[model samples]
Target: MKYLKNSTDTNYSMFLTNPEVICRKIGNGFFLLSSKKTWDKCPYVQQISETGAFYWNLLEKGIQRDEMLDCFLREYNIMREEASEDLDYYIDMLIEYHYLTKIE
Candidate 1:
């Protein structure tokens, strides 16, 4: 796991989908598959939970990081700190796997 980036930069809306990644709805969750161009980077299929699908859609639509935090808290029975931490980690993993690109 990478160190969480809980920065205060208001401009950091964070990860959006990478061009070569495909998101497909599967039941209540989602499947993340790397395109041919990204096969060398991350070739495995990623199965995500329904909660992850929610965030994935949000990020795909360019939702702000703060809004993401609020959504997590409102939708799940978790503390704000836990939501923030978990979201940060999920965003980090998406980037690591080439499924998402961090907006500069």
Candidate 2:
């Protein structure tokens, strides 16, 4: 599968606030706590499940998708195919919500 550079992700300046949420500015995207409060304010916020949140946290550290998929497959005791499908679905949702952007 093809992957875009981290730099192609969207600028999330409008979505973040509060120091306690623990945010890290990556190339363009940011990884932050998916808290209820944050979700409340940005109703469009992509609501990721716990597993999805785990991958998001890892991505913040510059981990790539393959590595994250490997970890999730091992940690969740799931098949690689299942992991990939879930990952793709959530990532697409994030993109659709403007939390992520493609590098055109």
The C-alpha lDDT values of all candidates are 0.70, 0.53
Q: Cα RMSD to native, each candidate?
A: 4.8, 9.5
- Summarize candidate 2's per-residue lDDT along 1-104 as a digit string, tens digits: 12433322443211212323443454545455445544643332334457766866655555566676877887888888877877767666655544444444
lDDT digits (tens) for residues 1-104 of candidate 1: 11112344544344557767767896766888777887888756899877777887777766667776787778889888877877777877887887776556
Candidate 1, 47: how far from true, in Å? 1.1
Clash pairs, candidate 1, are: none
Candidate 2 residue pairs that clash:
none
TM-score of each: 0.75, 0.56
Return the top candidate by TM-score. 1
